[model samples]
Target: MEAPHSIISIISSLLHIYILVLVIRVVLDLVAVFARSWRPTGPVLLLANLVYSLTDPPLRFLRRRIPALTLGSFGIDLSFLALWFGIVIVQYLLAILSGLL
Candidate 1:
């Protein structure tokens, strides 16, 4: 018989995928910052919009609750970092409970 996957394993896997998605969203936003003039066309724009829709909720929530990192005229949104940290901590705790780490 094949070994069955545990619920913790599935949850951990989903967490990992979500982490990647969140990171991609942040990286896309950062690149857009530098290349503001470039605009995506066709399906590219659709994909970008999809990512924006998925990632915006948590970012907006954190942005409202936490102050951003800033120096002089420039400011960096730390919500992405906060979200990533929070996800990793939960993943870590779950792994510990599952005895996978």
Candidate 2:
């Protein structure tokens, strides 16, 4: 039988990769927003669009249900941050549980 720790390690690693992808998507979106004058096209825009499509569905759904929190002129989108942190917390909990087992 496969050891529980090994299985948990595998799962955690997979989650870590997923988190990294999510972070990259967020960073790319921010960059695109700030660099709108540059006009990325062809493959670069295609890649960004693909990543946005993949990342936006869940965030849009959550955002519709949750109200945005405002701080003066800027409002924070907690839904995306919540999802990201939730994944991290889940990974940490899994690691801890796996260690205990």
Candidate 3:
């Protein structure tokens, strides 16, 4: 059987990769919003579309179930941040549990 530390290492690595993907998706969306005038064409558009397609399903579901917070005129996407933090917390918990095991 594989060692427990090795299993935890693998899980941690996967979680890190998942977080990186989420961060990339967030960054792309921010860029798309800020650079609206710059047309996303060819490979750039394809990459942006791919990221959105992959990330949007869970985000959309969370957004609907979670309430949006209003800060004066602007509303903040609490769900997005919550999801990001939730993932981090879960990763930390897994790491701690793995250490104990």
CA RMSD per model (angstroms): 3.1, 2.3, 1.9
Clashes of 3: 0
lDDT value for model 1: 0.82
The sequence of per-residue lDDT tens digits that candidate 3 reaches over residues 1-101 is 35988888888898788778788888887876899877678997897787777778878989999989998999988888877888889899988988688
lDDT of 3 at 64: 94
Which candidate, 1 or 2, would have the higher lDDT against the true structure? 2
lDDT of 3 at 13: 94
RMSD of 3: 1.9
The TM-scores of all predictions, comma-separated, are: 0.82, 0.77, 0.81
In the range 3-81, model 2's lDDT, one tens digit per residue, is: 8888898989988877777887877868768988766589978877776777788889889988899999999888888
Which has the higher lDDT value, candidate number 1 or candidate number 3?
Answer: 3
Instruction: Give me the displacement of residue 10 in model 1, in angstroms.
Output: 1.6
Which 10-residue window of candidate 1 scores lowest in summed lDDT? 1-10
